[model samples]
Target chain A: MQTTQRPAVSEAVAKSRKKRELIKNVVAYSFIAPNFVGFAVFTLVPMVMAVALAFLSWDGSTNNPITFVGIQNFIDLFQDAKFRQALINTVAYAVITVPLTMAASLGLAILLNQQIRARNFFRTMMFFPYVASMVAVTAVWNMLFNPAMGPVNMILSGLGVENLPRWSVDNNWFICMGTVILFSIWKFMGYYMIIYLAGLQGVNPDLYEAAALDGASPWQRFWYVTLPQLRPTTFFVTVMLTIQCFKVYDIFLMITNFGPGGKTRVLVGNIYEAAFTSRKFGYSSAIAMVLFVLVLIVTLVQFRGEKSMNE
Target chain B: MKEKSGITGGRIAVYVILILLSVLTIIPFAWMLSASLKLNKDVFAWPMEWIPSNPQWANYINIWTKIPLLKYIGNTAILTVVVTLLQLLTSSFAAYAFAKLRFWGRNLLFLGYIATIAMPWQVYMVPQFMMMSGMGLNDKLIAMVCLQAFSAFGVFLMKQFYDGIPDELCEAARIDGLSEYGIWAKIMLPLSKPSLATLTIFTFVNTWNDFLGPLLYLHTDSKKTLQLGLRMFIGQYSAEYGLIMAASVVALIPVLIVFLALQKYFVQGIASSGLKG
Candidate 1:
């Protein structure tokens, strides 16, 4: 009788434990359900569909049936001149803009981090362009850089410069792409500056003090102490900036209009033109896959580099 | 004496550079403000009229009548408020589960979010368009709301903050007969004011300034948002710089006000979360 009772008590305990576990899962899932349902339906499902759609052909017409095309879209993408030009233009923009923005923002961060008067005011001023509407910002930029009547040209003329390069209007890809790059750097540097400022705050003062005690100059101290300390922040910034550079669309569209005979056209612009304007949804998805792979490679490479640096 | 002089010279050089860059940064905004007050013809007058002799207050008034500006503003305001509130509610709820709850498959579920966050939305936007259209949500403000509301970034940011709050507090609250939901609402939400403000500013500003999402989703005039409205205004009145600037100013005012009021939280939010705003 005693043995049977002991087993019965143990069985009851086990059943209750399972019941509690079930209840816990139900509650936990309930907490995440509101967001997860929406996320799964919109983001996750679409992502899987995007991968499949890249291998299919659809013109985004109601009447056109979706059909599997194998790797034909990708094959066509590589052989397409417009896509090749776009890929090159995008790489050019990223290569030129990313490093310049990084260096400028880092320099600004180091400068502002010093014990300077009106630091907050300066920082706020720098960050103002970032918060402003891109439409408005682009409008003002087009006006300012307008060759015919822009103040920049007016000032340059005053300086006796004859060739006021047709900045936004110039059919020359360099002039057009260069102007967009300049604006991109100006508009976004402040954002990265703030991130760098946060990184600066985390750097221990003792390292700087020790470097100074060893009679290190300001530049030397920065190179040896400040930079090494800010490695993680720099890594984060590079990954973010690289991904952002790949996704450049609005500024290109608004500023260049992919103009000068499609010279300033980037990969995203190519995708937009294909998907929306031409309604070739499958081809667009294929281009998007290329974009995805490029972004993935850059990010993975950065992460690998970061791991090696840590070791 | 030499060190003192060198330090003073360096400080002066810093100030000079700072002032120069500040002027370059503020020039566009200043030009916008000045141009918004001028006549269309006078907007690009040579040598630049930094100040108009007589400000055309009518540009501001005319912008309202130009293209259903009031309707656009109303649409934007509604989207901003609704999206921000929904994101706050859902993200914090999801984050609480991720951070505090010891549930099965927690890490795996959260991994899905982190992975997707890294993937560009453009990569999947075609399928998303099809899915939304199939669901009969395309060309509807509800589509934008559905797409933007459940942000993984919001959940990630909130979870980062929630992870910092000690689990012992939740355990103590549970002992006091409070349920998990009660602990999230009564204990967690109250302590997360700063993070809430951060998320609020982020969602508000992004929703407000968003051009791409609305461009793709909203095509109807009545459904159009401020960014799209502003673009249409530009297309129609390409030469009316003053009126365009006025419309742009009107569109930007709310975001500016929100940013200014919550400026401290905005800076602190970015710093603490290390988010790419």
Candidate 2:
């Protein structure tokens, strides 16, 4: 009778297996190595350099040397009128954009969550603008707001309203701000609507059905059942909106460029102008440093908020 | 029954309101097209001519004359395709490693990659420009392609996709004596076809529409992207409105075509990225 013997994995065989595992690891690291090298050179090195440069003063021209001035940049920034204006504008933008974007997106999300007809078509239609080139979208806005031969003025004329405000009129600060706010909201609402839709999809359907059978009205169901379920999504969206609003530059650049005496100038635009245009690299780095800290703090708070929510 | 009817009425009201909101979103693009169809004299009419009083289909003809849009299209297309292709090659390799190949400091290294996306380009603007200038890459298309190819988000995006795949597939391939590279090529890649399509479309659109990077890096007017080229089309004369709008319409078409084709995955892809803002 021939006995069936299980062949053992020999010592040489085990070493070969181990060598193959080692080779797999080496291959993995080599693939990841290039990205890490790039990130370190670009992201990490620059980040440290920015923080260090914030304490120094340099004209940013190739000829100049950086003069070490501890805390003076930050101190001078508080008293600087442009800095003050930028801070106010940034904060005001956050206030206007954050709440309104959330409310609009939420309202749209709830509207979309319903048993509606041709929903995906409407969803796509809304999202297309967000995806449209800034050049194209801004041009449309520019033409629409143009005082002469523009549709906005034409619509006003039809209603017989004389001297209607040109939305992005030069040197009119509030009007320019109003224009920025309107454009931002229009561009964003669709993107957020999708997020809300995703959040809506995640909510337990049976919860709504049970509430309905219990004689809960649609509004009641949304307010209690839907809103509670969506709180995390709302929090997530709010954090994202804050980051994006703070980083507003593309639209500002494409539009009047914070025109009418730098009234609409945002922090990112300010950083660009300071470093690239005016050759004030130290000060620009200073501004960037401050902006980075603000972002860090806000993001940390969001993490904390999420942690608490999970708890 | 009256209360129930009222509730139903409210739901209808919500849908109507949402639909109206969606229309307002599209109305601006519609007006742009409509205005582009008008004659030079008719474009700026006070009553905001809904349909051009005198339809000049020649506005489309005039785009070629006003600026070299076809060259811009060629430039943007060539740059976007190169960037997308390079990004796919690099990102997929790294993503495969992160997903299937467990090595030392794997988690730490992946964390390092995600952290790169948080740093805005403005932070790197001057240094990157300086680096490109030093390399004598100024006024060159390759600089634009390279800048976009060294993408942090692409790696992160592809990793998330690779993670969705089952590890058992790779393990089974391993037991059959297939190499790690073989498993990635044969199994993981085929499973993530939809995701790669999503990434391709997203990366293509971003590289195409991006004006700031090209505006900064691309010194020569000839090397400019479509969006930048569209800006060059604007003349001091308001009479150029027809031509300008026509150019804008031209720029919008390729993106719209892409959107129409991949939109199902596009919307879901964006939402899945946890970057809704």
Candidate 3:
């Protein structure tokens, strides 16, 4: 009877412990429920809908039923000339802006890292553009890019340069892309510079001191020591800048409005015009799918790079 | 003496280059200010007026009266504040679960959240609009707020901070018979103030300056945000450079104030996020 009673007591204790564990799980899940639910409803569900919508035709109206068109949306998108232009423009923008911004920011970071007067002030001023409203900054750039009476052209002609391109309004695609890239580099470099500055803080100072003690010139020290030390930061900045450049929309919208005849259209801008202007929800989703693939590839590459670095 | 002179030359060169770059960076802003104070005709004057001979303070007043600038600003402020607070609440709660909780499928859920961080909004714009409209949330401020409130990036950021904290603290609180909610509210929230501040600034700025979200969701002029309002103002009054610049300046003031007040946190937030610009 005593042995049976002992077994019953142990069983009760084990059962209570299991109940407590279940209760703890409930509490933990309850804490996550609100946010996770919202995320699922808003983001996750919509993402799934986007992928599905790419294969279906919908005019984005309540009356029109979503029709399954299979691969026709993507097939049409591939053949569209404007989509091709947007693809090229987006790639061009990324190709030009990412490296330029990276180089400029890294340069500024190195300069700021030096023993300089009013370093914080310089850093803040450089970063001011990043925090400013894009609408406002692009509006100002619009005025600056004014062909006839703009300061840019005025300064260029003052330097005795003849036949200046109309900057943002230039019919040439490269010129239009260049204007957008210039604005991007100006706006984004400061933020990257701050990242590089933080990266610089992590680099062991003793290495630099040792390089100097080895009679290494400043340039050699920078090339041999600083560059290798900053490889991780450089990689991170490159990936981020590439991703942002692909999504470039607002500046082109405000500055060039696709440049004379839709010359400066980008992937995001194309999606916006397709969905909002044309009201072709299916077609826009197809374009978005292309963008999604591009970004996913870049992100995957970054993750693989990070994993290797960690190893 | 030669080495000291060489150092002085290098220092001078650095100062010169930095100052030159700073001036170049500031040129557009300075031109905006000057143009905001000039008359419409004088705004595009040749040689570009670095200073307005006669300042037109009335452009600011005109922006207010010509359009619903104040109302747009109010809408933006309300949306920004609400969205920022909601993101902080949701993100911190979700982050706590991801960081401290020992539950089934925890790592899997976190990985799902991380996967979405790189997914651009363009991918879901059309579908999200449809979903919002289906839920009768289109053209509503609540739509924008709800859409932005749950950010994977925000969760990831706060989780990184939370992970740095020792689990022993939470265990100790649990041993004291405190509930998980109690531990979160009492122990977690108090310790993660810096991360909270960083997310607050980031969400506020992003929401405030957001153009595409407002453009898609808020169709009515009355519900328009500052960025959308500024865009509309530019569309209607592109030729009126003075008034446009004045409106842009007015729109920029709040962001500048927030940035100036919390510049440190902004930098920290970006650095910690590792990918945010």
Best candidate, TM-score: 1
User: Model 3, stretches more than 4 Å misplaced?
Assistant: A2-7, B275-277
Candidate 2 — what's its lDDT? Answer: 0.79
lDDT score for residue B96 of model 2: 86
lDDT of each residue in B1-277, candidate 2, tens digit only: 9989997898788777876887788899988998899876777676566777677898899787768788899999999898888777778778888877889788887877766566666665655665666677878988787677757787788888888788888889999998877887888778887777878888888898988888777767678888888875663444587788888899989999998899988878767876432
Task: Let me know the DockQ for model 1.
Answer: 0.71
Residue A171 of candidate 2: its Cα lDDT? 65
Per-residue lDDT tens digits for candidate 1, residues B1-277, read: 9999999999999999999989988898899899999987888888677889999999999988889988998898899899999999999999999999999999999999987777788888878988999999989999989888998999999999999999999999999999999999999999999999999999998899898889889999999999999998898888999998888888778878888788788888888877332
DockQ, cand. 2: 0.52
Which of the predicted structures, 1 or 3, would earn the higher DockQ when compared with the native? 3
Using lDDT as the yardstick, the better of models 1 and 2 is 1
Query: Residue-wise lDDT of candidate 3 within B1-277, one digit each (tens)?
Result: 9989999999999999999999999998899999999998999888666777789999988989999988999999999999998899988998998999988778888888888887888789789998899999989999999888998988898999999999999999989999888998999999998888889888988999999898899999999999999999899888999999999888888888888888888888778777432
